[model samples]
Target chain A: MSEFDLIGRYFAALGPERSDVVLGVGDDCALLEIPAGQTLAVSIDTLASGVHFFADCDPEHIGHKSLAVGLSDLAAMGAEPAWATLALTLPESDENWIRAFATGFGRLASAHGMRLVGGDTTRGPLSVAVQVHGLVPTGAAIRRSGARPGEAIFVSGTLGDAGLALRRKLAGEPVAPELWHRLECPEPRVALGRHLRGIASAMIDLSDGLAGDLGHILAASAVGAELELERLPLTSWVAEVVAATDDWSLPLASGDDYELCFCVPPAHIPVVERLSETLGLTLTQVGWIRSDAGLDVRRPDGGQLRMPARGYDHFPAANDGAD
Target chain B: MSEFDLIGRYFAALGPERSDVVLGVGDDCALLEIPAGQTLAVSIDTLASGVHFFADCDPEHIGHKSLAVGLSDLAAMGAEPAWATLALTLPESDENWIRAFATGFGRLASAHGMRLVGGDTTRGPLSVAVQVHGLVPTGAAIRRSGARPGEAIFVSGTLGDAGLALRRKLAGEPVAPELWHRLECPEPRVALGRHLRGIASAMIDLSDGLAGDLGHILAASAVGAELELERLPLTSWVAEVVAATDDWSLPLASGDDYELCFCVPPAHIPVVERLSETLGLTLTQVGWIRSDAGLDVRRPDGGQLRMPARGYDHFPAANDGAD
Candidate 1:
């Protein structure tokens, strides 16, 4: 089929029809309206097959994860997801694969009321690049550099269940469907992020694990952090995986959880409590920011827990990345 | 080097710094302020090595052309280029290669006062995805469906030089430096497109060759076109290639010419002429829109010139994408 035909069949109408999109798919460019007094939060991410995902994995999960990761970035900035443009590189024209991918993508995008405004489909080794645009009130974006020394560090949802799933699968062991689902379909904390716009002083998405990703917040804010290791949020599946693999690094330094890690000053903790109750999400306060300048992970008994040797780097890495 | 270090070394400061960017590369999402009374125009395109260009070719050109193509789409909408996000996937961390690539990308972006607000760099087979955001006055952006039956069709710049260069390279023949340069670095018609905002009824960027790309305009506007084949603007090199290769398809059906194809009402011709002179660029009138609903290419003797059998398709096609 022609490139245009493939685009029409799978991607012409994948998400909600937002009124903000003036000229959508099948245009030289998509024209959109950003309301006055709002800032545009834009993020671009690429998921390369074999590097980011296995080729044999379900295409639906690939589609879901691709948009999820970019939305996660927007969520980090307390932006409401608006529009996305996809540049999909395929090895060949496989209608079934494309359809499944679109289904997965459409479901999440529609749920967020985000629209697919533009796309380019081409032949190559499979890679998907998603650029998501979101909106936040002018000057109200939560940046990583805003955390203060006395702020309480909080992370939404369980840590590293996605990485734990991959580890179990790679070890040739039986994996729970729940664990695999977490690996495949991460929920971007869009609503909670927007609600925390004024309450959270700093925010980041947990893509590169809590220990490393939170370090970004510390480095940018020029503050230190002390994490209570026992308070690290976990699912039963993650606990089982950690006990079996005997590796704390999956929860500490591996990647792809897609959860929001943020800091709330002492006075805002009450507001966070009200938000957690309203949103019905597990908002765990695992640590606090300090005046000193380094990350310290503590044991329940108060000695420091040794951190991983390296963070998950996509290139030249000690981590296998399911290698 | 670590992923963070790689980003800082190569991409952190690769484009012009603009005041509109509230937060740039290091943030989870780039925060940009789009002015009130304006609309956002967005476009995304990907170029994969060995699919779009030779993998062994200069990375600098890859960087330049990647941004050029997306900018061409924005230009088609008569939008002012503002920001670009690069999602670069490389096979390895070759610092010199990345530095050269950044230099090429930086040059074009700075020339237009555009900034690199965000990026994702990861290990994979070489592919570059560029998403560009530009601005146009509310309801003033050009669309492909705006042409009327009596409008004159115009195209900017000489056509087919890029395709001819690729054809010669693939045919194992010596290619001119000028022609090869066209293949590597085609200029985007940003200024002319912005100038034509109120004047041009319809517009498209010629990424695919004249005959095929022009067909998109005809199809969208639901009108016919009659082209005076002799009036097609061409460099002497293109005429030489046509004579030597005896392949009209290079000029008519291949891809990668970044020229703007547009329609102007007869009354606006004087304005176009004035702008052309003021800008010191070639703007050729090649055809006129008709009430009928198909395209006709008339030879100098008033006979029809039989068009090529196929237009370029990125997948399942007769044309080698220089394949």
Candidate 2:
């Protein structure tokens, strides 16, 4: 099909004007009118083949994962998902691949109430870059600089599953289907982030490993952190599976978790509990914001735990890196 | 250097914040608040190496050209450029390339008063996609559907020079350095677009060749066109060059001419002339919108001009059923 016809058939399916979107997916440009008394939060993320994902991963999962990575940023700021634009580079224009990608991307977009407003498709090696925009009430966004010295550190959902699942996939192990699913599709904790907006002092999504990502919050706020290794919130199934293996480091330094981590004041403990129960989500208090400038881990026996502190660095792997 | 360190040193330099920019680059997300009574006009364009430019093109020009492409979209909507976000895909982390790119990008951005807001950098084959946001007063945007029959079709600047320059560069012709510069740095007419906000009925940027792009305005407005080929505004040098060439097809149908083509009512001709002189830009009447649905080009001898229609199509060349 011609490029225009292809776009009209496949891409036009991604958007149609909704009440909030003044214009969607057509013409020379897209028009949007932000609602009064609100701030627009914008973030962009790019995922490359063999860099952000495995070389043989499913195309549908890649589509879902690309949008999810950008959504995670919005979740971190407690913003309501609004609109998105995509830039897809492909080696060839495959009709089947385009249809499947649009379907997967459309599903996530509909779920999050995000309008796929515009994008560009071109011939190149496979990669997907998405820019997402969200809305938050005036001055109400939960920034990383808002954390205080005595605030309680919390994380949603289990950690290291995504990283561990990736390892299993790479090793070609006979793992359960759930492992593949976890490695393929990650759910960004958007509802939990919104619930924590008014209560949490600081927030961020765990794209890099939790140990590394938490450091971002600390550095941004110019504060420090104390993490309890025993309280790291590993799932029972994960614990059992790792007990049979010698290496458990993946769980601690695995990236692509898409989980929310935030700092909340001591006084809001009861309110946070209520929110967790209401959202039907697990919220584990794993650490505390420190007055000092370095991160330290405490063990179950109250001994200091030394961690090499490495995660997914965008550059080549080096031994001396911290997080 | 690691992606984190590279971002800290170079990517962060693109953003240090400025007036009219509520938030600049950095943080988990960038925040921007559109002015009250203004509508945000956004456009996205992706440029892939070997597709948009030659493999040996300078990194600095590539960065500048990428932004220019998106900015032209804003000019079509008669919107004032405000901010932009970039998504860069590279084959490897090259520090020198990144520095040169930032330098070129920063020069244009500073000159246009556009702030770099948010972006993503990833490892992949070379590609640069930018999304630009412009502010236009509500109800004042010049859309593609507003042209009425009998409106004068006008274009700013000479056509086909960029495409011709590219041919010259590809053939290693070293006539003048300015010709090569024009091929690499075709500036978007931002001031002209903003000034024409109340004057033009329908407007569009000519990136996809005059015939193909002007057809868009025709199709969207549900109208037709009659072009006077003799009236096409070409530089004296370009006219002489095309007259001697065996085929003037590339000059007519080749893409990458980032000039503004617009439709204005006959009553506004005096104002257009005044504005053209004031801005020191030559605005020439090229054609007229009609009630019929087919394009007709009138030659200088009052005969029909049958020109081959060619422009950049994303699908493989064979898909044109040269398949």
Candidate 3:
């Protein structure tokens, strides 16, 4: 059978049922009804074998990570998940592999209320490109340029577990199962992001580490920040790992956390805290936005702390793989 | 500089200015205001190096073809182009190459009234995946499943030049400049497609050759067709090539033509003819849909003609590239 035939058999039936999707996989284009007075939030991400994941990684994990990364962008924008299109390139058509991959992708898609609308299957080196479309009220999307001076900076959930897991995996050292899971299938805080929409002033997802992604918000907003190192939330395992290695930089600059870092006014802190309590998810205030020019790292004793690296970079050298 | 930095410098400013796009690059997600009562049509296409094009082909042509193919899907759906997201993977960061590519892509985007919203830049084997979003009136999209028996089959423009060009390029034979141009930059019939929205019964873009793509519409609509070999609209050069080789299969099975094929009722034939005159495009009625099951080709002498291979197959073996 042809590549198109394979997709029609294994992937076409995986989409969620939604009235908004007027037409789906069979057509040259998928038609979706965008409700009145709503804006569409769109983002695309490409994950390549040996670059974004291990070449020998599980196909199911590859599928999950591919969609999760793109959905995180919608979460950061505080948009309601709606539809997605996938462009998959493979070295060969493996029926079992495609089935597992579809299952992994379909499960996450159903949970988030997003439907697979259309896609293309091609033969090439293994790679997956996912473009997600979501909806938000017109002019109501939270952006990266709304932070102001004196606003509190916050992040949802713990950090650095994925980075630690990557380090251990690369070194062939023993790793905790939780850390491994974080490395393989990082959860996107979609619900928390949607809840924080009108509350947060500026927001960004931490795919490229806290320091770097927050730096993006600051640069866009024309502000700066002072992060209190001790206030950074970390799990017991991460804390222990950092202490054992005398390296606290992992939590500060580790990429692939996929948690949200946002800023809000001081007056809204109570409401945000109440939201945190209601959702039973950690929303730690790690820093404050300032009118100054650049980011500063501060110790609890009022001394200055040095940064290790800015974050993960796709083009560190000419021959390296992308993030 | 990093890959993100490269994108910020080169690609961020390439987006067209559109008020519907609330946000462009440099954000977690790009927000687009969908006009009330309009449905969004979306399609994605990926062009991998050495698979879709020669590994050493010009980057400018690669960039143009990448976006054009996705736009053709919108044209086939009778949707007005609106926005696009590009996920580009490159083996290395070549500043000059990137600048030319951006120029080629930006020119077509501006012409089509589509804005570049958001995308990812990655390092890997070179590939360009473009997802295009277009707008159409609610419940007005042209679908492949709407064709019926007794409708006349029509196609816009000439066919088989791209296929002829490919064959010449592979065999190290001399090719006409026009044929080479057609292979590199076949125009998508966006305006004509929009005009045919209410007139055509069923529509699809010719990507995987006429026979294969027309087969898709037949399978969806549960109908058949009879094509007249002598009635196929062809350029003088393609006719000469076919006569010299004593093979008409090139025009019948050549991919990458990027033309529109549709079925119109007998009553609408006059309207289509008027449209063709207005657009100065060739819209030749080459066949008719039938109640029978399979496609039949009739020669000038009323003799039945057998088809050649059913167009390009991505997985003919395990090592071939996708069309």
Residue lDDT tens for model 2, A99-118:
87888788887888888888
Error of 3 at B260 (Å): 0.4
Q: Give the docking tier of candidate 1.
A: medium
- Segments in model 1 whose C-alpha atoms lie over 4 Å from true places: A243-246, A306-310, A317-323, B244-246, B306-310, B317-323
For candidate 2, what is the lDDT? 0.80
Candidate with more favorable, higher DockQ: 1 or 2: 1
Q: What is candidate 1's lDDT per residue for A157-228, written digit by digit as tens?
A: 898788978877888988789888888888899999999998999999999889888888988999988998
Name the 10 consecutive residues with the lowest summed lDDT in model 1 chain A.
Answer: A314-323
TM-score of 1: 0.96
Ranking by lDDT: 1, 3, 2
Per-residue lDDT of model 2, residues B279-321, tens digit only: 9999999999999876787877788864333346777554442
Chain B TM-score of every predicted model: 0.95, 0.93, 0.96
Instruction: Count clashing residue pairs in model 2.
Output: 0
Interface RMSD of 2: 1.8
